[model samples]
Target: MAPKVLIVLSSHDHFPANGKPTGWYLPEFAHPYHVLKDKAELVIASPKGGEAPLDPNSVEMFKNDPVSADFLQNSQELWKNTVKLADVLPKVNEFDAVFYVGGHGPMYDLHYDPTSLALIQSFSEAKKPVSAVCHGPTVFLRATSASGQPLLTNASAVTGFSNVEEDQAGLTSLMPYMLEDELVRVTGGQYVKADQPWGEKVVVSKTSNGAVLITGQNPASATGVGQEILKALGVN
Candidate 1:
């Protein structure tokens, strides 16, 4: 059977800091979706269920990118008919992996959502791959293992939306906390980044217990993150 992957999206439609419109980033989801669509069975889900919003700025910024544009046109139903995250938590064993798609939106909701955190813990306990790209990794900021230890404590290396990238975007002050800084502090400097800002960077960290954590630095690293997930799942 094909590996089943749960694709988690943020249901938040706006940034709490300023009430500005924000949702999952287009390319972050689109690029990774295309990469895994052929090899895995994917189920879309979110915190609040129903239609998950897309970041308007990301849609506009990546409109010219063919893969993202095509996904926007053809994959609307996927995001629109999302299953409630809490409902899926009980069925965590049904999936082989869990992937978090990033946008500024997750920083508001999934960042602290207990249900989402629990699901990540479940996946980790099951030895299934837990992966995210860009701001999506923010959800891991609070996730813990079944043993009550910080989930990141086991990660030897990880990467996410970096402090430099956040500053470059000029939206650092608006975020509740800097992702890179917190990740570094949590993982004891396990956080990694690309050589330059906005460059593609994907890190695969395997915990001592054999749990896999795959992370990407930014939207540009989404595809690479997806590919790493497939490899982790033993998919050719």
Candidate 2:
């Protein structure tokens, strides 16, 4: 049997009434799903579970992308199969990897979620790959190693929605905190970026033990992020 990997998504759907858009981008979720579904047994989970919200902009674009449109057509079935975040009592030793999909929602929900933190730490402790992207890294802000050091601190390379991208999206003023800056500050890990907005792909940082932590800049990098995860899993 192929190794199983858990894919955690944010439960948040709507942005504040301020009219700013948020939630997981269609490509971010769909691209990874397409890649990993064939190679690993994937278990999707969310903080609140049951029908996670899809971003409106993402939905609009999904209609235009054949791959995404197909996924949406099967969304109901997908939701039915998803394991509730609370129900996923993940034993790091049992899974080969854990992937946290990002959106503005993660900044609001996953950042302080104890279960989410435990999942990441458990994966790290078990020497399994732990992957996240965009604002998904927010969860790491509070995750620490067994030694109490910040999990990503000086251990892995990381990236997220850059300050430049946040500013462009006009969310810099509304969000509770900046993700890119905080990741670098808290972990002292080197943060890199692509040259253009929404064009950055995945960057994988490997530990001496060969465990990999990979991150993508935004939705555009989702496919690449998924591919990196496959590579780390030793899949061709």
Name the top TM-score candidate. Answer: 1
Cα lDDT tens digits for candidate 2, 98-138: 88888788888889988888777777777888888778777
Residue runs of model 2 more than 4 Å from their true location after superposition: 16-21, 207-210
C-alpha lDDT of residue 74 in model 1: 94
lDDT of each model, Cα atoms only?
0.92, 0.78
The digit string of per-residue lDDT tens for model 1 on 96-128 reads 999999999898899999999999999988899
Candidate 2 displacement at residue 79 in angstroms: 3.7
Worst 10-residue stretch by lDDT in candidate 1?
205-214
Evaluated against the true structure, the overall lDDT of model 1 is 0.92
Query: TM-scores across all candidates?
Result: 0.98, 0.90
